[model samples]
Structures are given as structure tokens and as C-alpha cells.
Target: MQKTKLKALTKILGQTALIALITFVMSEITLRIYNKINPSFVFYDSSYNRFRGKPNAPDYDFKLNSQGFKDVEFTVEKPAETYRILGIGDSFTYGVVPYQYNYLTVLEEKLNKSGQKTEVINMGIPGMGPRDYLSILVNEGLKLNPDRVVLSFYIGNDFLDNYMTANLRTEEKSYMIALIKSMIKIQSNYKGKVLNPTTVQYNDNLPTFTDEKYLEDTINKSNMFVRNPADGMFKGFVDDAVKDLIKIKQICDSQNIPLTIVIIPDEVQVNSQLQKQVKQAFDPNNQNLLDFEISNRLLTEQLQQANIDYLDLLPDFKATAQKTPLYKPNDTHWNIAGNRLAAELITQHLTAKNQP
Candidate 1:
């Protein structure tokens, strides 16, 4: 009886192991194909303080270069008579739209179209902040010998992004496990909300963004805009962000590379209609509760003191926000129109300096 039972147990164990192996192989194959359509783009690396793109991740639309960034592979030896600008920032710089529609791409095309040979390298990574920008510049940016560095500072959550990165858990290294986790997380989050390149593929159509809960959450989450960066509820994040920005400037100056900080304004600060809604939901009675431009004013003040050459896009964006759709509905990042506007403005500014 004992011999018979032992043999039966061994047979069961072997069957289970075979089944598990088959399941793992099938799951890996499925994930690899899914990644082809919407790549599992960015990952948290032990080597860096922030999230970076998955190297050579090619989706249906765009491919991250060999360096794990949105732009093409960059060689340290820049071509002669070619001007290269290292574009830096978070998702806005990494881009939520198609690759060709990003401001960096548009800016490069516009500059080249006007007869000046220029290469605008997109060094932007999603979920990055001032500190991450500084890190990338130190690690890979300076080696490229860029002529200029234009760092795009989004007003929405850069300060918050900088602060929260310290607490985020690193993602799994295994592709199948990572993809499974990513899918589960995406489904758990609000519907129609695009989080990362891995979550959703870029499209020309806008998302269904009328989820009031998402709007309220976005307001409370990004409410740092309602006060001065120095004295507000988000003082710690603001201070940390500023210190990193100053360090970035110092590094660029040390290398004799001109750094231009492009301040991308938040939509709440610029949109009065949205402000009314925010006021009602967030502060029912106070008309003056939200101070939209205070963040821009305070941040720019620090930049001026540091003598950092900066471009405040608030005015231009405000002037154009209503007439043109700058931000995607309910989403903090810019849509296609917003990208085009920024490209146009930056191109005008850059070209204005060289024109006779």
C-alpha cells in the first residue's frame, strides 16, 4: 500500500510541474506580442533615482532609441555644422502624443524647415522631476556635447513628482511579471486615464475625461498650484525642486552649456472656467482660495535670482489656451495642439535670437 501511494504522489507532482511550465511559457509569449502593440516602456532602475524608458521598446507607433529614450540614438561626437539641443523634462517632454507630434520633434522640424540644421534630442522620461533631469544631464547629457539644453518644467506636478519618487517601489525586472502587474495596475486606476506608454498607445482622439471623481482627485493631488511654492502646503517639494533646478543650472554653467528653463504653466492657473469648478468642488465659498499664478511667480523669482535664463509659457499659453485646445480633457499633460503651440513659441524664441 505504501509503495503504491508513493508512486501516485510522484506522478501527480510531475503533472503539476509540467502544467506550470507550459503556463509560464504561454504567458511569456502572450506578453511579448502585447508589448509589440503597446510597449512596457519605462521602469524604475537601481542605477537612477527616477523612472526611465525600457530600452529599445518599440510600440505600434514609436520606438525608444538605443538609450531607452524617445529620441534617436545619440553619439558623443556631434556632427559638424549641426546644432543639437538636449530637450529635458518629464512626460510632457517624453510626450503623450505620437513621437512626431511631440514638441521636440516639431521644434526640430520647424528649425530645420526654416533652413537651419538642428537636432533636438528628446531626453525626457516619464515620472521624472528636477532631480531626475539633473541626474540624466550628469550621466548621459553632458557627454553628448549638446550646444544648448532646454529643460521643460511642467507646472502640474513636477514638484510632487520630485517628492514622491523617493517613496515609489521599483518595478519587477521580469517582462511577463512586469506586464501582468502593469495591466492590473492600469485596470485598477480610473478608466480612460492614460498613465504611461505601457498602459495605453498614443492616439489623435481625446480620452473620455468627464469622470468627476478623477477631476476632483486631480485637483486635490495637483492643488499645489493654489499657493506660493515657498510658503504653500507644498513647501518641501517646492524647495527640493528648486534646489535641483539650481544644481542643474550650475552643472550646465560649469560645462559652458547654455541652459534655458521653459516653464510650462498648469491648466488650472490659466483656465477660468475650470477654476470656477475647482473652487466649487474644493472650496465651496471662497472665490479667492486658488492662487494660480503664484507658483509661476515664485518659481520664476528664484530663477531670476539664480540668473537662470528661463521662458515662462504662462502668458502665451493662457492667451492661446481657450482658442486652441492646449491640454487634453481631464488630463494634466498637453494634447497635440498644446505640443504644436509650445513648438511654435519655442521656435520663435530660439529663431528670434539668430535672425537679423
Candidate 2:
């Protein structure tokens, strides 16, 4: 009786293993074919110590160029009448919306419409900061021989992002894993877009965003207001950001190229009501703990000292934020309106610069 029972158990186990194997293979095959049709996932690049979009992949439906950047294929030689501006930064510069809706694209159209031929090559990548910017500038930006450079600096969590770039980890190369990650990221992004799902968190030690949309990513993006326990660093993050920019300045200076900065403010800074909510969350007794201008003012001072030209969008954004929804409902990025506003403002700035 015992031998018969053992034989039956062994058969059951073998059948279960076979079923799991078949399911995995089928799923893998399906994913492979699906990816071929619509390839849009980022892969870890050991050489650059960053995640680059797959060549020719339509990442976020914004088709990447041959070089993996979300811009048109650029020639090393500049056209005689065409002026090229190389735009670089983190996600803000990468843009969440489609390529057509991106501010850089709008800026280019505006420039060209105004009778000056221009091309804005976007070198933005999501989850990147100062360290990554430096590497990209050295490796790729200079090679294109751009006439000008425009850097987008987001005040929200760029300082934190800058400091955290030190902690880089190698992601496992797995198709299934990459697919799941892409799905989760896209789903989370859509959930808050045009909707306010990312409510403020009260925990002082925890990251500001407690919503499921940003929970997985919150640990890394600590803004000026919140002091994430894991990092045990915030103020220094500001200094480190400026430090990196100074280095970028030195490089541009050596080449005799001009660099301009566009300061992108955090949503909390623009949304007055959100300010109250975050204040209450952190410390109701001291509602003024979160100062919106702290990050901007600090960075502004450094840029001025370095003689760097900048266009701070915070004032204009705050002025019209209540009148219109400049940012996505709960997300940190600029909505369509905000992007348009940025393009218009940049148009005024650039046109004025070329006036003389």
C-alpha cells in the first residue's frame, strides 16, 4: 500500500512540473512575438551605467531615434542655415506625453515658424540626474556639435535624484521581468494622469508619496520637503546638484559653447492647496515647514554665481496654476497646457537672445 501511494505522489509531482514548464514556454513565446511588434522597454546598459531605450523602440509611444534617444536622427554636421539646440535633463526633458506634445518639439515648431530654422534634440531620459547628465554630455552631446545647449532642471526631486545616482544597481536581464516592469510603470502613470490618486503621506520618515502609483519609486525621489529615513541626506543633495552643474559648465566653457538652464518647479510648489495638505501631513503645528522657494532660490544663487543664464518657470507657473491645470492631476510632470506654456516662454527667451 505504501509503495503504491508513493508512486502516485511521484506521478502527480511530475505532471505539475510539466504543466508549469509548458505555461512558461508558451508565455515566453507570446511575449517575444508581442515585443517584436511593439518593442517599448528600457534595458540596463552597463557601459553608460544607465537604462537606454532599445534602438528603434517606441518607448511610451514616442519613437526613439536610431541612437536610442527620443529625438530625430541627428547628423554630426550642422546645416548651414539650421541652428540646433541640444536639450538635456531627467524625465521632464524626456517628457511623458507623445513626441508631438513634447515642449521641445513645440519649441522647435515655434522657432521655425518664426523664420529661424531650428532643431531641438532631446537627450532626456527618465530616472536620470546630474551624474547621468555628465556622462551623456561627454559621450553623446558634444559629438553632435550642437550650436547651443539647454538643460532642464526640475526642482521637485532632482537634488535627491542627483545624490542617489551614486547607488546604482545592475538590473537582471530578463524579458518577462522587463515586460512586467513596463506594464506596472505605464499603469501607475495612467492611474494618476487626469486623476488625483497620489495623496500625500504623513509619515516623516517615509517618502512623501504613499499612493500605490509611486510607492515603488517613492523611496528614491525625496524632495526638499520630506526627509526620507533611508537616505539620511537632503541638504547635501542640493549642494551636490550644483556641483554637477558646475562641472557641466566647465566642459561647455572649454568648448566655447553656451549653456542655458530652464528651472522646472515641483507640483507642490505650484498647487497652493497641495501645499496645505503636505504641511498638515508633515506637521500641522508648523505648517510652513515646506517652503516652495527653498530649492529654487538655492539653485538660482549658484547658477548666478557661475554666470549661467536661466529661465525659471516657477513664477509664471504659480501665477497661472490656479487659473489653469498646468500639471497632470496627481503626477509631477507638466500637462499639455504646461508644455505649451513652457514652449511659449522659451520662444520669447530664445528669440530675444537672437535679437542682437
Please name the candidate that would achieve the greatest lDDT relative to the true structure.
1
TM match of model 1 to true structure: 0.78
Give me the runs in candidate 1 sitting further than 4 Å from their true place.
Answer: 1-50, 168-184, 190-202, 208-210, 227-231
TM-score of each: 0.78, 0.74
Clashing pairs in 2: none
User: Model 2: runs farther than 4 Å from truth?
Assistant: 1-49, 59-62, 168-223, 226-232
Query: For model 2, how does the per-residue alpha-carbon lDDT over 1-356 read when each residue is reduced to its tens digit?
Result: 99999999999999999999888778767766775564433433333334455557664445588876778788888878888888998878877666777899899999889877888898887777777777789998998887788899888767877544455343334556666776676565543232112242211122223355443332224246553335745657778988888898899998887888899988777888777666666678975555667778878988999888889999999998989978764557787788899989988887888820
Candidate 1 lDDT:
0.78
| Model 1 Cα shift for residue 126 (angstroms) | 0.4
- Model 2 lowest lDDT segment of ten: 195-204
Query: How would you encode candidate 1's per-residue C-alpha lDDT over 1-356 as one tens digit per residue?
Result: 99999999999999999999999889877766765554544333333433566777764367788877888777889988889899999888987777888999999999999886888999887777787888889988899898899999988888777666676554465566776777776766546644344556766555545557556766786567554444555766767888999999889988888888999987776777877778787778876767778778878988999899888999998988778778877677788999999999898888776720
Residue 130 in model 2: lDDT: 77
